[model samples]
Target: MEILSKNLQLLHFLDKEDMAGFWKLKMMILKITSHSWRNWISI
Candidate 1:
C-alpha cells in the first residue's frame, strides 16, 4: 500500500510537469506564428 501511494504521488508530480511543458510549447508556437504574421504584414 505504501509503495502504491508513493507511485501515485510520483505520477501526479510528473503530470504537473508535463502540463507545464505543454503550455510552454504552446506559447512558443503562438509566438512564432505571431512573429511570422508581423513579417507577412510588413511585406
Candidate 2:
C-alpha cells in the first residue's frame, strides 16, 4: 500500500511538470503564429 501511494504521488508530480511544458509550448506556438500573421499582413 505504501508503494502504491508513493507511485501515485510521483505520477501527480509528473503530471504537473507535463502541464507546465504544455503551456510553454502553447505560448511559443501562439507567438510564432502571431508573428507570421503580422508579416503576412505587412506584405
RMSD in angstroms, all models? 8.8, 8.4
CA lDDT scores, all candidates in order: 0.91, 0.91
Q: How many clashes (backbone N, Cα, C below 3 Å) per candidate?
A: 0, 0
Q: Tell me the TM-score of each prediction against the true structure.
A: 0.67, 0.67
lDDT by residue (1-43, candidate 1, tens digit) is 9999998887677877797897999999999999999999999
Q: Model 2 off-target regions past 4 Å?
A: 1-14
CA lDDT, candidate 1, residue 29:
100
For model 1, the run of ten residues with the poorest summed lDDT: 10-19
lDDT of 2 by residue, 1-43 (tens): 9999998887677877797897999999999999999999999
For model 2, what is the C-alpha lDDT against the true structure? Answer: 0.91
Q: Provide the lDDT at 26 for model 2.
A: 95
